[model samples]
Target chain A: MLYLDLTLQGLIQGSMYALIAVGLTLVYGLLRILHVAHAGLFTLGAYIAVTVTNAAGSLLLAALVAVPLVGLAGMAIYRLLYEPILHRPPFVALIASIGLFICMEEGFRLVFGPYGNSFDLSPVEGSVQLGALSLQTVEAATIVAAFGLLGALAVFAGRTRIGVAWRATVTDPEMAQSFGIDTVKVRYLNFFIGSALAAVAGVLVALLNNFVEPTMGSVPSYKMLAIIVLGGLGNVKGTLVASLALGVMESFGTIYAGHIMDRDAIAFLFLVAVLMVRPQGLFGKA
Target chain B: MGAYELSLLTLIGINVLLALSLNLITGFCGQISLGHAAFYGVGAYTAAMLTKAGIGFAPALVAGAAGAALLGLIVGIASLRVRADFLAITTMGVGFLFLGVVRQQEWLGGELGISQISESGLGETGFLLLVLGLAAGVFAISLYIKRSWMGFAFDSIADDEDTARTVGIDVARYKLVAFALGTAIAGVAGGLYAHYARIIVPDAFGFTVSISILAMVVVGGIGSTVGVLIAAVLLTLMPELFRFINDYKLLLYGGLLLLTMRFSPAGLAGLARLGWTAGRKAERRPA
Candidate 1:
C-alpha cells in the first residue's frame, strides 16, 4: 500500500518535471543556450496566476490569463536581452540570462513581497480512494492537465506548419533560413511556446503546493537542468522518461536513505553519474 | 585606519583573490565553472574544522587549499568529456550537492553553520597585511604564469582544444592543473574569509557568490589580471558606497552585467587598450 502511494505521488511529481524539462529542452534545441531565466519566468507565472486568481476568484481564468502573459514576457525578454548577443559566445547569452533572472526574481520580491502567497485555487477540497490507494483531486488534475498539454504539444510539433518550422529551425537554422523560413520569427515562436509550457508547469506546481513565492523556482529550475541532462539535452521523449525515472528514484531514495539522501542530492548524484558514464546523455546522439 | 575600514579592505582583498581564482579558470583556461563557490565553501569548512581541532591557522589554511584542490581535480576529471554547456550545468549540480551535504551534516553545524570561531590572534591590521601579502603573491604568480610556457599551453587549449592536442600539448592534464590551481587559490581565499568573519555558512557560498565572482572576472576582462583585480575592488566597495539604494543593488548588477557584455565583451581591459591605442594615434598625428 505504501509502495502504491509512493508510486502515485512520484508519477504526479514526474509529470510536473516533464512539463518543465520539455519546455527547457525546446528552448535549448533552438537557441543552444541554457535559459536560466526560465526559472524566474516560472516564478513570475505562478505569482501572476495567484494575483489574477485573487482579483478574479477563478483558478481556470487565472491560469488562462497568466500563461499567455508570461509567454509574451518571455518573448519580450528574448528580444530585449538575448537577441543582440545571439551571435556572441553561448556563455555570453547564459550570463545575460542570469542577469535577467536576478532582475525578475528581485523585481518579484519587491512587488509581491518576500512572503509566500497562498495559491488559494481551492482545488476540489478532498481526497479520493481507488482500491487500496488514495489520491488528491489536485494531483489527479495535475497529471491529466500535464498529459493533455504534452499531447497537444506533440501533435502541434508533429503536424502543424509553424511547429514543423520550429523543428526545422532547431535542426538547422541556416538551412531552414535558406529554405525561406523566417528563422527569427520561428525563434520568437519557439520562445513563446516554451515559456507557455513553463508557465503551465508553474501554475500546476502552485496549485499542487497551494503556495507561491519568488524563490520557489530556484531549486526546481536546477532540478530541471538535471532532468534535461539525464534525459539527454534537447530530447523531449528522453526528458519525459528521465523525469519519471528521477521522480521515482528520488521518492524511493529519500525513503530508504532516511534523512541524508535528500531530493537535490539524489538528482545531483544521478546527474554526475550520468555525466561521467555518458556525457552525451542516455538518449542523446553522438 | 579604523577597524571598520580595515575590515572592508580585508573584504576587498578576499574578493580580489576570489576573482583572480575564477579568472584563472574561466578567463585563462576557458572553463565555465558555476560551482566555484563550492570550492570556496570547502576551504572555509576545512579550515574552520581543522582550526577547531587544535591545528595551527597556517596549517589549517594549507589543508583547506589541499582539500579544495582535491575536489577540483575530481570535478575536472569528471568534466573532461563534457563541453561548455554541459560543464556549466555539471558544476552547478556539484555546487548544489555541496550545499545539500553541508546542510544535512550535524558535525558541520548543519543549517546554523559553524560560528564563534576562534580568532587568528592577528588583529585586524595583521589580518589585512596577511591578505594583502597573499593577494600580492597571487598577482605575482599570475603574472609569471601569463608570461611562461604554461600560459601558451593554456591559451592554446582555450582557443581550440583539438588544435592544442594536435600540437602535442596535453590538454587534459593542463586543464586539470588549471582547475587545481584556481580552486587552491579560492580555498585560500575562503580560509581567510572564515577566519576574518569568524563565521562560515553554506549560504555564503551559493550560486550568487559564484556569479558575483564571475561578474568580476568578466567585467575586469578575462585573462587580464590587473583588470580583474581593479574590478573586484570596485564591485566590492561600490555597494557600501551606495547604501541608500541597497535593495536594488542586485538589479543594478544585473543591468551592469548585461550592458557590459553587450557593449564591451572584452570588459574594462579591452576598453582601456582601445583608449591607449587611440591616444597614441592622436599623438603620432599631431607630432
Candidate 2:
C-alpha cells in the first residue's frame, strides 16, 4: 500500500514533468534550440496564476489568464532572442536562452520581492478515492489536466493540417519550406503550444505546493534536460515515457536516498547513471 | 593601494583566470559546458580543506588543481560519448550534483558553508600581486596553446569532429586535454578565490557563476584570449562601476550575454573584424 501510494504520488508528479518535457521536446524538434527559458515561462505562469488568483479570487480565471500569455511570451523569445542566432552554432542559441532565463529569474526577484507567494483563497480540501487508492484534490486535478491536454495535443498533431505541417517542419525545415508549409508560422505554433503546456504544469505545481518562488523553475529546468536526453532528443513518445519513469525513480530515490543526498542530487544521479548506461534504442537521437 | 582596492583587483584577477579557463574549452575546443562552476567549487573546497589541515597555500592550490583535473577527466569521459547540446546538459547535471552533495554533507559545513578559510599569508598587495602574476601566467599559457599544434587539432575538432577524426586527428584525446587543462585553471582560480576572501560558500559556485564566466568568454569574443581577459576584468569591476549592478548582477550578465550572442555571435572579435573590414573597404573606395 505504501508502494502504491508512492507510485500514485510519483505519477501525479510525473504528469507535470511530462507536461514540461513535452514542451521542450516540441521546441527541440522544431528548431533544436533547447528552449531553456521555457522554465522561466513555467515560473512566469506560477507567478501570474498566484497574482491573478489573489486579485480575482478564482483558480480557473488564473489559468485562463496565464496560459495564453506564457505561450505568446514563448513565441516572442523565439522571434527576438533565437531567430538571429539560429544560423550560428546551436550552442549560441543555448547561451542566449540561458541569459534570457537568468534575466527572467532576476527580473522576478526584483518585481516580486524575492520571497514567495501563496494562494490566498485555498481550494476545497477534497480527496478522490479509487479502489484502495486515494488522491488529493490538487493531485487529481493535475493528473486529469495533464491527460486531457496531452491527449488533445496528440489528436491535434495526428489529425490536423497545421499539425502535419509542424511534423514536416520538424523533420526537415528547408524541405518543408520548399513544400510551401509555412515553417515560420509552424515555429510560432510550436512555441505557442509548448509554452502553453509548460504554463499548465507551472500552475498545477503552484496549486500543489500552495506557494511560488523565483527559483521554482530551476530544478525542473535541468531535470527536463535529463528527460529529453533519456527520451532520446526530439522523440516525443520516448520523452513521455522517460518523464514518468524519472518521476517514479525520483519518488523512490527521495524515500530511500533522501538521507544520503537531496532530492535534486538523487535526480541528477539518475541522469549521470542514465548517460553512463546509454541503453541503445531508448536514448538514441530522434 | 588601499586594502579594499587591492582585494577588488585580486578578485578581478581570479575572474580573469576563470574566463580564460572557460575560453580554452568552449572557445578553443568547441565544447560547451554549462556547469564549469563544479570544477571551480572542487578547487575551492580542496584548497580550503588542505590549507585548514596546515598545508602550505601553494601546495594546496596545486592539490586543488589536481583534484579538479581528476573530476574533469571523469566528466570528460562522459563527454567522450556525447557532443554539442547533450554535452552541455550533461556538464550542467554534474554541476547540480556538486551543489547537492555540498549542501547535504555535514563535513562540507552543509548550508552554512566554511568560514575562516586559511589565507595565503601573502599580505594585501602581495596577494594581489601573486594573483595577477598567476593570471598572467595562465594568459601566457593560453597564448602558447593558441599558437601551438594542439590549437590546430582543437580547431579542427571544434569545426567538425567527424572530419577531424577522418583527418587522423585524435578527437577524444584533445577533448579530454582541453577539459583537464581548462578545469585545472579554473581550480587554480577557485583556490585563489578561497584565500582572497578567507571564506568559502557553495552559493558562490552556483549556476550563476558558471554563466557569468561563460558570459565573459562569449562577450569577449570566444577564442580571443585578450578580449576574454579584458571582458573578465570589466565584468568583475562592473558592480563597482554601478552600485545598482551589484543587486542585478545576474541580470546584467544575462542581458549582456543575450544581446551579445544575438547581435554578434563572434562577440567583440566579430565586431572588430566588421569595423576593420569597413575601414579597409572605405580606404579602397573612391572617397
Candidate 3:
C-alpha cells in the first residue's frame, strides 16, 4: 500500500514534469539553444495565474488570460531581443536569456516580495479513500490534465501546418528557410505555444500545491533540463518517459536514502551518467 | 585613497580577477558556467577556516587556491563528457547542491558565516594598494596565457573541439587545465575577499555572484582579456558610483548585459580587434 501510494504520488509529480519538459524540449528541438529564462516565464505564469484568480475568482478563466499573456511576452522577447541577434553567436543568445532571467527574478521580487504567495485552489478540500488506498483530488486532476495536454500536443504537432513548420525548423532551420518556411515566424509561434504550455503547467501546479513563490520555478527548470538530457534531446516521448522514470526513482530513492539523495541531485546524476555513457540519450537520434 | 575611492578600487580589483578567471572557461574554452560562485565560495571558506586555525594569510590563500583547483579538477572530470548547454545545467545543479551543503553543515558555521577574520598585516589603505597590485599581476599573467600555446589550444577548442581533437590536441585535457586555472584564480580572489570583508557567509556566494561574473564576461568580450578587465572595472565602479541605484543593481546589471551584447556582440574586444587589424595594414603599406 505504501508502495502504491508512492507510485501514485510519483506519477502525479511526473505529469507536471512532463508538461514543463515538453515545453522546454519543444524550444530546444527547434532552436538548439537553452532559453534559460523560459523558466522565468513559467514563474511568471504561476504568479499571474494566482493574481488573476484572486482578482477574477475563477481558476480556469485566470489561466485562460495568463497563458496568452505569457505567450505574448515570449513573442515580444523574441521580436525585441532574439531576432536581431539570431545571426550572432549562440553564446550571445544564451547570455541574453540569462539576462532576461535576472530581470524577471528582480522584477518579481520587487512586486511580490521575497517570501512566497499562497492561493486557495485545491478543490479536493481533502483526500479521497479507495480500497485500502487514498488520493488527493488535486493530485488526480493534475495527472488527468497532464495526459490531456500531452495528447492534444501530440495531435497538434502531428497534424497542423504550423506544427509541421516547427518540426522542419527543428530538423534544419537553414533548409527550412530554403524551402519557404519563415524560420522567424515559426520561432514566434513555437515560443507562443511553448510559453502557453509552461503557463498552463504553472497553473496546474498552483492548484496542486495551493501556493506560489518567485523562486519556486528555478529548481524545476534544472530538473527539466536533466529530463531532456536523459530522455534524449529533441525527443518528446523520451522526455515524458524520462520524467516518469525519474519521478519513480526519486520517490523511491527518497524513501530508502532518507533525504541523502535530493530529487535535483538524483535527476542531475542521471543526466551526468547518461551524458557520460551515451551522449545521445536513451531515445535521442544520433 | 579616500574612503569611497578606496572602496571602488578594491571592488574593481576583486571583480576584475573574478571576471578574468571566468573568461578562461566561458570565453576561451566555450564552456558556460552558470554557477561559478560555488568555486568562489569554496575558496573563501577553505581560506577562512585555515586562517582561523592559525595559518597565516599567505599560506591560507595558497591553500584556498589549491583546494578550489582540486574541486575544479574533480568537476572537470565529472563534466568533460557533456556538451555545452548540458554542461551549464549540470554545473548549476552542482552549485545548488554545494549551497545546500554549506547551508546545512553546522561546523562550517551554517548560515551565520564566519566573522572576525583577522586582516592581513597591511592596513586598509595598504590592503587596497596590495589588492590593486595583485590585480595587475593577474592581468599580466592572463594576458601572457592569452598569447601563448595554451591560449591557442583553448581558442581552437572553443572554435571547434572536434577539429582540435583531430589535430591531436587533447580537448578534455585543455578544458581541465582551464577549469583548474580559472578556479584557482577564483579561490585566490575568495581568500582576498574574506580578509577584506572580515566576514564570510555562504549566502554571499550565490547565483547573483555567478550572474555578475557571467555579465562581466559577456559585457567584456569572451576571448579578450582586456575587454574582461574593462568590463569588470566599469561594472564594479557603477554600483559604487551610483549608490542611489544600489537596490536595483541586479536590474541594471541585467539591462547592461543585454544592451552590451546586443549593441556590441564582439564586446570591447571588437574595437581592439579593429585597431590591431588597421595598424597591421598601415605597417604593411607604408613600411
- What TM-scores do the predictions have? 0.96, 0.97, 0.90
Candidate maximizing lDDT: 2
Give the TM-score (0 to 1) of chain B in model 3.
0.92
Against the native complex, each candidate's DockQ, computed on alpha carbons, is 0.64, 0.73, 0.45
In model 2, the runs with Cα more than 4 Å from the true position are: A279-281, B284-287
Clashing pairs in 2: none
lDDT of 1 by residue, A129-242 (tens): 778777888888778888899999999989999888888989998999999999999878888888888898888888778888878888878888889888888999999999
Kindly report the docking quality category of candidate 2: medium
By DockQ, the better pick of 2 and 3 is 2
- Please give, for residues A1-286, the per-residue lDDT of candidate 3 as tens digits: 8899888778888888888888778777877766777788888898988888887787778888999999998788778887788777676787787788778888888899888777754433676676777777777678888899899988987899977887888889999999999988888888898788888888878777888887777778767877887888778999999989888877887787534444555676667667767767778877
Q: Clash pairs of candidate 1?
A: none
Using DockQ as the measure, what is the rank order of every candidate, best first?
Answer: 2, 1, 3
Interface RMSD of 2: 1.3
Residue B97's C-alpha lDDT in candidate 1?
88
Judge the docking of candidate 3 as incorrect, acceptable, medium or high.
Answer: acceptable
Each candidate's interface RMSD (Å, one decimal) is 1.6, 1.3, 2.5
lDDT of each candidate versus the true structure: 0.87, 0.89, 0.82
* Clashing pairs counted in every model: 0, 0, 0
